[model samples]
Target chain A: MRIALGAVAAVAYAVLLLAPLAVIVYSVSPGAALEIPPSGASLRWYAGLADQPRLISGLFTSLLLGAIATGAALVTGVPAALALTRGSLPGREAFLAVLLSPLSLPGLVLGLGVLTSAAVLANATGIRTAGTLLPLVAAHLLITIPWVVRSVAASLESTDPALEDQARSLGAGPFATLFLVTLPSARAGIVAGAVSAFVISFGNFALSLLLASGRTVTLPVAIYETVDRYQDPTVAAVSTLTIAAAVGAAVLTDRISGPLKTRDSSARSGQPAGPAALEPNR
Target chain B: MDRSRRRVAGLLLLPALLVVAVVAAAPIGLLFRVALYPPGPVAPLTGGPELDSFAGLLGAPYPSVALRTLRLSLLTTVLVTLLGFPVALFLSRSRGLSRRIQTLLIVSPLLMSVVVRAYGWMLILGRQGFVGETLAALSLPRVGLLHTEAAVLLALTESFLPFMILALAASLDRIDPDLLAAARGLGASSARTFFAVVVPLTLPGFVAGASFVLVGSLSAYAIPALLGGSAARTFVMEIYELVTISFDWPTAAAASIVLLLFASALLGGAALLSRRRSARTFGT
Candidate 1:
C-alpha cells in the first residue's frame, strides 16, 4: 500500500511540475508547430513576442499597475501591520480580520462588486471610473493589502517589543523608533510582502479581466485573448518570460528571507496555513 | 494602550481601513443592493428595487450550473487531497538539500500565473497536442479532450495540488513523533498508528486544504473557460457570461452573491469542523 501510494505521488508530482515546463520547452522549440521534443532548439518564438503589439503593451500596463498597487499596499499595509502588532489596541483580532477579509473573497465576486461600485460612482458624479486605471488600482489594492499586512505583521510579531521600548527610552521619538528599530527589524517581511503583492497584482487575471478596458489590457488577459484567438508559440514565449521573472523574484526573496523561515516555522505550525496564510494568487 | 497611543494606532490604520472600505466593503454592499434591483435593459438599477434577479437564479440553467460547479469543485477537492497526502508525507520526511529541492519543485509552479499553467494544459490536451498524438501513435482513435470536464478537472487539480500539499505538510510537520512511537509501542500496527494518531492530528490541515481547494475550484474562471469551454459551464463562467454577454448585471450580481454564499458556507463549515476536532483532540 505504501509503495503504491508512493508511486502515485511520484507520478502526481511529475505531472504537477512538468506540465508548466511543457510551456517553457515549447516556447524555445524552433518551428511554429509545437512538437513535444522539437527537432532543434531556437529562440524564434521568443523573438516573435516582439511582433505582438497587444501583448507588449499589456506587459507594460501590468507592470505599471502592479508597481503602483504594490506601492500603495506597502505604504498603507506596513504602518497598519506595525500598529496591529505594537499598538495594544482594543479589538485587535477584529480589526485584523477586517483588514484581511479581502483575502477570503473570490476574485470574480470582488471584481464584479468593484465594477458595479465604479458604475454607481460614475452615475452619481458624472465621471466614469471604469475602463481606467483607477478601478484597476483600487481592485489590486484590495488584493495586495492583506498580503502586505499579513507578511509584515508576522515579522513584527517575532521581534521583541522591548527593543522598540528601549529605543523610545533612549530619546528616540515614535517615528524614529519605528524607522530605526521596528521597521528595520521587519525588513525581510517587508521585502517578502512587496514581492508577493507585486506578483499577485501582475498575475491577476479575473479581476483585471473585468476591470480592464481595451486600452488598459493586462498581460494575462492579453494572453487569454491570444490563446483564444490563435493557438501559437508566441503566447508560450510570453508565458515563459513571466515564469522566468516569477521564479527569479521568488528565489531572490527566499534567499533574502532565508533566516526568517526557521523563526516562522514555529509560529506557523500552530495554524492551519490555508491559502490566505500562504499567497492566494488566485 | 493610552488614549493618545490608541489614537496613533488608529491614525496609522486609517489608510488601509479607508482603502478596504472604498474598494471592498462598499462595493460588496453595492453588489447586494444591485442584486435587489430588477434586471433592466439599459442599466442595472434603473427600475425599482426588487428581488427579481434573485428569483431569476431559481429558474432553469442557473441551478444546473451551480450544481455542476459544486460537483466539479468537490471532485477537484477530493482529487487534490488524495494526490497531496503522500507528497506532503514525503516532503515532511525529507531533509536538508533534498527537502529544499522538492519544496522548490512544488512551489515554483505556484508562483507562475494561472493563465500560463492553464495554457500549458491546453497545449497538452488540444486536438493536435501530446495526448492526441500519443493516441495516434498507439493506433487508437484520436479524441479531443480540451473542451471536456476531465481536462478542466486535471488542470484545476494540478493548479491547486500545491496548496493542498503545503497545508498538509504544515500539519504533518507538526505531528509529534513521540505520539506515533507511543502508538506503535502500545502494540498498534503501523497502519493502525497512522490511522489513530497521524490522521486525526492532520485533520485540521486536511480541512484547511480541502476548503481552499473547494472554494478555489468553485470560483475558478480561467481553467474552466480555457479547458472545459462550453461543455462545463461553471458558476463563475455563468456569472461572467451574464455580465458581459447577456448584459444582465442584476442577475450577475445575484449570481455573484450566490457564489459568495457557497464559498462562505464551505469556509464556515470547515472552520467549525476544525474547531470542534481541535477542541476534542486537545481536550480544551
Candidate 2:
C-alpha cells in the first residue's frame, strides 16, 4: 500500500515538474508551432542558435557576470556571516536581519533602488554612469549576498565551536586558525553558496532588464528579447542549453556537497537530502 | 581589552559592512529619498518636496495593479502548498536510491533559470501549445490560457512549489518516527495517524513551506513579466514600465517603495508566524 502510494506521488510530482520541459524539448520543429508529440522533430532550431551571435555573446556575459557576482558575494558575505555566526557580537540577530533585508525586496524594487541611487550619484557628481558594469555588479551583489551569508551561517551555526578553540590552544594564530580550521569546516557550505549564487546571478532577469545596457546583455535578457521578437523554437533551443548548464551546476553542487546519509539506519527515514541539498539557493 | 576585541570583530565585518551599505542599504535609502523628494513643476529642488508621488499611487490604475500582483501571488502560494505537501510527505518517508532520484526529479525545474523555465512554459501554454491541443483532441471547447492571468498563476506555482516541497520535506524529515509509530499502534487508521500525529508535527514545515512560496511568489519578476503578458502586468512589470517606458522616476521610486513594503510585510508576517510556532514548540 505504501509503495503504491509513493509511486503515485512520485509520478504526479515528476509529471508536474517535467511536463512543460518535455513538451518544449519534444516539440521543437523548424518553422512549425510547438505541439506535444510534435508532428515532426528537427534540430534545425538548435542549429539556429549559431545564427544569433547576440545570444552567444550574452551567454558569455552571463557567465562573466555570474562569476563576478559570486566572487563579490563570497568575499563580502563570508566574513560578515562568520562575525554573526561565530563572534559574540551584540545585536547580531538584528544585524543578520538587516543583512538579509535585500532578500525581502523584489528584484524590481531592488533594481529600481539601485538605478535611482546610481542616477542620484551620477547627477550629484556630474558623471555619465547609467550603462556601466559597476552598477550591474553592485545590484547583483545585493541579490546574492543574502544567499552566501545564509548558507555559510547555517554551516557555522551547526559546527562545533570547540574545535576552533582547540586549534587556537594548539598555537594556531587567528589568521592561520581561520584559514586552516574555520574555512575548511565551512568548505561545503561556501562551495554550495558559491554555486547557488552563480546560478542566482546568472538566471536573474528583472535586474538585468533594468541594469543591463545594449553592450551588456545577460542570457536571461537575451532570451526575453528573442522570445518577444520571434515566438519560435529558436528560443526553446537557447532555453534548452541554459537549462543544461544550470542543471549541470545543480547536480555538480549536489555531489560536491556530499551524498545523502545513506547506509545509516538511524538517519535513514527523513529527507535523504538535508536542507542544504535542496535550498532554492536564490 | 573589551573595546579591542570589539574592534577586531568590527574589522572583520568592515568590508562586508561597506558592501552592504553601498549595495543594499544605500540604494533602499536613496529609493525612499527619491520617492519622497518628488520635484514640483519647476527646476529640481526649487520647492520643498511633498509626498505627491505616494499620493499618486492611490489613484485608479495603481490600486488594480497592486491588487492583481497580490492576488496572483496569494493564489500561487496556496496552490503550491496544496500540491507540495503530498510530494514532500512521500519524499521524507522513502529511503536511499529512490529518495535521491526523487530529489533530483523534483528539483529539476529549480535548476533552470527563471527565464528558461518561463520560456518553456510559454511554449506549453501558448495558443498552439500542447495543453491547447490536448484539450482540443479531447473534443473539449478549445481553451487558451496563455496571455492571461491563468498562465502567470501556473508559472508562479511551478516556480515556487519546489521551495515549498524542500522546506516541508526538511521539517517532515525531523518528525520523530516513534511518535508516528505510537499513533499507529494506538489503533489509529493511517489517515488518523497522518492527521493526529503527522500533520501536527509537520506544522512547522507547513508554515516554513508556505512562507517560502509566499515570499518567493511575491518577489518573483521573471515569471509574471514573461508569462503574464503586456496587459497582465505585475508590480515589477509596472515598475519596469514606469521607469523604462514612461520615464517617470519619482513615481517609479514611489511604486517600488510600495512593492518593497508589501514584500517586507509578507516576510515580516512569515517571520512572526515561525517565531510563534517555535515558541509554542519549545517554551513551557
Candidate 3:
C-alpha cells in the first residue's frame, strides 16, 4: 500500500513537472496556434524565432545582463559571506537580513522598488531615467546576490574557521590567509553560487519587467510582449529554448555542486540558497 | 588581528551593503514616500506634499482586488500544500536514479522563466489546447479553462509548489526513521504512525512550506497575469495596471505598500505561531 502510494505520488509529480514539455510539443505542432493533441509536427515556429528582432535582441540582452549581474553578485557576495560567517561583525543578523531581504520580497515589490527609485532619481535630477541598463543590473544584483551570499555563507559555515587561524599562526598576513585558506576551501560553494546567481538572473522576469524597456528588453519580457499580443507557437519555440537552458543549468548545478551530497552538511540548517525541500535525510 | 581584521571585515561588506541600500532599501523608502505624496510622478529631491493612497486604496476596486488576491492566495496555498505533501514524501523516501530524476523534475520548473512556463500553460490550457481537447473527449461540454479563477488557481499552485515542496521535503528528511519504526512497532498502524509521529514533528516544515507558498501566491504576478487574465485582476496586477494604464505611480506605490503589509502580516503570524510551537517544545 505504501509502495502504491509512492507510485501514485511519483506519477502525479511526473504529470505536473512535465507541464513544460507541452511547450516543446506545441512549438513543433504544425498548427499556427496551440493544440494539445497536436494536429501535426513541424519546425516552422522555431525557424521564425530567429527573425523576430525583439526576441533576438532580448536573448542577447538577457545574457549580458545576467553575466554582469552575476559577476557583481559573486564579487560582492563572496566577500560579504566570508565576513559575515567568519568576521563575527557586530549586528551580524541585521546585516544578513538586510542583504538577503531581496530574496524574501516577491520580485513584484523588488522590481517596483527599482522602478520607483528610478522615478525618484529622475524627478530629483530633472533627467528622464526610466528603463536604463544600470538600474536593471542593480536590480538584478539585488535579487541575484542572495543566492551567492546564501550558498557561499553555507559553505563558509561548514569550513573550519580554525583552518584560517592556522594559516595566520604560520605568519601569513590577513590578506594572504584569506586568499590562501578561506577562498580555496569555499571554492566549490563559490562556483556553485556563481552558477546559481547567473541562472537566477537569467530566469528572473519580474524584476526585468519593471526595469526593461523597448530597447533593453530581456527574453522573459520579450516573451511577455509576444504572448500578450499573440498565441502563435513562435513564443513556444522561445520557451523551448528557455526550457532547454533551464534543464542545462539544473544539470550543471547538480554536477558542479554535487548538490545532493554536500547538502547533507547544511541540510538541517536549511541554507538560504538551497531547495531544502529535496535535501535527503542522512 | 582584532581591530584591523574587524575593520577590514566591515569594509568587505560595504559594497554589498551599499548596493542593497540603493537597490533594496531606498526603493522601499521611495515606495512609502511617493505613496504618501500626490498622484503624479515622484520628485526624489523636490519631494511633494502627502496624499493618502492608503485611504484611496481602501476605496473602489482596490479593496475588491485585495479580496480577490486573498481568496486566490488562500486557495493556492491550500492546493499547493496538499499537492506538495505526496511529492515531499516521495522525495524523502526515494533514492538512486528515481531520486535524481525526480529531483531534476521538481527543481527544473523553478529555474525556467515565468514567461516560458506561462506560455507553456497558455498552449496546454487554452480552449483548443490539449487540456481542452482532453476535456472534450471526456464528454464534458466545452469547459474553457483559460482566463478564469480556476485556471489562475491551477497555474499559481504550480508556480508556488516548488517552494512548498522543497521546504516540506527538507523538513521531512530531517526526521529520524526510528521514531516512525517505533510507532509502527508499538502496533500503531501506518496511518496512525504518519499522523501521530510524522505530521507532528514536521509542523515546522508545514509552516515553512505553507508560508513560502502563501507569500508567493499573495504577490504572484506572472502566472496570474498570463493565466488569470485582465478580468481576474490580482493585487499585483492592479499595481502594474495602475502604473502602466492609469499612469498613477502614487496609487501603485500605495497598493504595493498595502499588499506588502498584508503579506507581511500573514507571514509574521506564521512565524509567530512557529516560534510559539518551538518555545513550547523547548519548554518541556
Candidate 4:
C-alpha cells in the first residue's frame, strides 16, 4: 500500500512539474507543428516573437500595469498594514476581513462587477473608465492589497514591539520611529508583497479580459487571442517566456523573504509561506 | 491605543478602504442593481427593478451550465484532494534542500499565468499532440482530448493540486509526532493511528484546500475557454459570452450574482464545517 501510494505521488509530481515544461519544450521544437520528440531543437520560435506586434505591445502594457498597480498597492497597503498591526485598532478582525475579502471573490465576478460599475460611472459622469487602465488598476489593487497587508502584518507580528517603543523612548518621534524602526524591520515582507503584487497583476487574465481594450491588451489576453485564432508554436513561445518570468519572480521572492518565513512561527505552525498563503484567484 | 493614535490609524487605512469600497464593493453592488433591472434589447437596464433576467436564468441552458460548472469543480476538488494528500504527507516529512526543491516544483507553476498553463495543456491534449501521437504510435485511433470535460478536469486538477498539498502539508506539519508514537505504543495499528489521529487533525486543511479548488474551478475562465472549447461550457464562460458576445448585460449580471452566491455558500459552508470540527476536537 505504501509503495502504491508513493508511486501515485511520484506520477502526480511528475505531471505537476512536466505540464508547464511541455510548453517550453514544444516552443523550441524545430518544426511549425507542435509534436512530442521533435526532429530538432531550435530558437526559431523565440526569434519569431519579434514579428508579433500585439504580443510585444501587450507585454509592455502588462509590465507597466503591473508596476503601477504594485506601487499603488504598496503605498496604500503598507500604511494599512502598519495600522492593522500596530495601531491597536478596534474591530481589527472585521477590518482585516473586509480588506482581504477580495481574495475570496471570483475574478470573473469581480471583473464583471468592476466593468458594470465602470459603465455606470461613465454613464453618470461621462468619463470613460472601462477601456482605459483605470478599472484594471482598481481591480488589480483590490486583489493585490490583501497580499501586502498579510505579508507586512505577518512580518510585523514576528518583530518585538519593544523595539518600536525603545525607539520612541530614545528621542525618536512617532513618524521617525515608524520610518527608522518599524518599516525597516519589515522590509523583507514589504519587498515580498511588492513582488507578489506585481506577479499577480501581470499574470491576471480574467479581470484583465473584462477590462482590456485593444490598446490596453495584456500578454495573457494576447496569448488567449493567439491560441483562439491559431495553433502555432508562437503561443507556446510566448507562454515559455511568461513561465520564465514567473520563475524569476518566484526566485526573487524566496531570496528576499526566506529568512522572514523561517522566523514566522505561525507560518511554520500552519500557514503556507510566501505568495502561496492566499489564493490570488488567477 | 489613544484616541489620537486611533485617529491616525483610521487616516492611514482610509485610502485602501476607499479604493476597495469604490472598485470592489461598489461594482458588486452595481452588478446586483443591473441584475435587478429589466433586460432590454439594446440597453441593459431599460426599466426599473425587476426579475426578468433572474427568471431567464432559471430557464433552459443556464441551469445546465451551472450544473456543468458545479460538476466540474466538484470533480476537480476530489481529484486534487486525492492526489494532493500523499504529496502533502511527503512534504510534511521531508526536510532541508529536498523540501525546498519540492516546494519550488509545486509553486512555480502557480506563479505562471493560467493562460500559459492552459496553452501547455493544449499542446498535450491537441489532436496531433502528445497523447494523440502516442495513440498513433500504438496503432490506435488518435482521439483528441481537447474540448472534452476530462481535459478540463485534468488541467484544473493540475492547476489546483499545489493549493491542496500546501494546505494539507501545513496541517500535517502541525501534528505532534509523539501522538502517533503514543497511538502505536498503546497497541494501535499504523492505519488505525492514521485514521483516528492524522485524518481528523488535518480535516480543517482538507476543507480549506477543497473549498479553494472548488471555487477556483467554478470561476475559472481560461481553462474552459481554451480546453473545453464549445463542448464543456462553464458558468463563467456563460457570463463572458452573455456580456461580450450576446451583449445581454442584464442576464450576464444575473449570472454573475448567481455564481457569486454559489461560491460564497460553498466557502461559508466549508468555514463553518472546519470551525465546528476544530471546536469539537479541541473543546474550544
Worst 10 residues of 1 chain A by lDDT: A267-276
Instruction: Tell me the lDDT of model 4 at A205.
Output: 94
- Write the residue-wise lDDT of candidate 2 on B138-212 in tens digits: 777777777889989987887777777777887788888798788888899988988887887777777767766
| Local error of candidate 1 at residue B211 (angstroms) | 1.1
lDDT of 3 at B18: 94
**Per-model RMSD to reference:** 2.2, 3.3, 3.4, 1.6
Instruction: Write the residue-wise lDDT of candidate 1 on A39-75 in tens digits.
Output: 8898888888889899999999999999999999999
Interface RMSD of candidate 4, in Å, is 1.7
Best candidate according to DockQ: 4
**Best-performing candidate as measured by TM-score:** 4
- Stretch of 10 with least lDDT, candidate 4 chain B: B39-48
Residue pairs clashing in model 2 are none
TM-score of chain A by itself in each prediction: 0.92, 0.86, 0.88, 0.94
Which residue segments of model 2 deviate by more than 4 Å?
A1-8, A19-28, A35-40, A260-282, B1-6, B37-48, B133-142, B184-189
Q: Candidate 2's residue-wise lDDT over A1-282, tens digit each?
A: 677657657665764566446435643674656554456678887787788888888888888999999999999889888888777789888888777776656676777777777877888897757877788898888778877887777667656789998999999998998999999987766887888788888888877778887768888898888876676676677777777776677576657544423333214335423223434523
Model 1: CAPRI class = medium
Better of 3 and 4 by TM-score: 4
lDDT of 3 by residue, A1-282 (tens): 668658757765765665698888878989775544557789988999878999889989999999999999998999899889987798998899788767767787778888877776787897766756888899888877777887888778878889888998989987898898998888777877887788788878877787899778898888988887786788888889888988887777666555635454754533223432222100
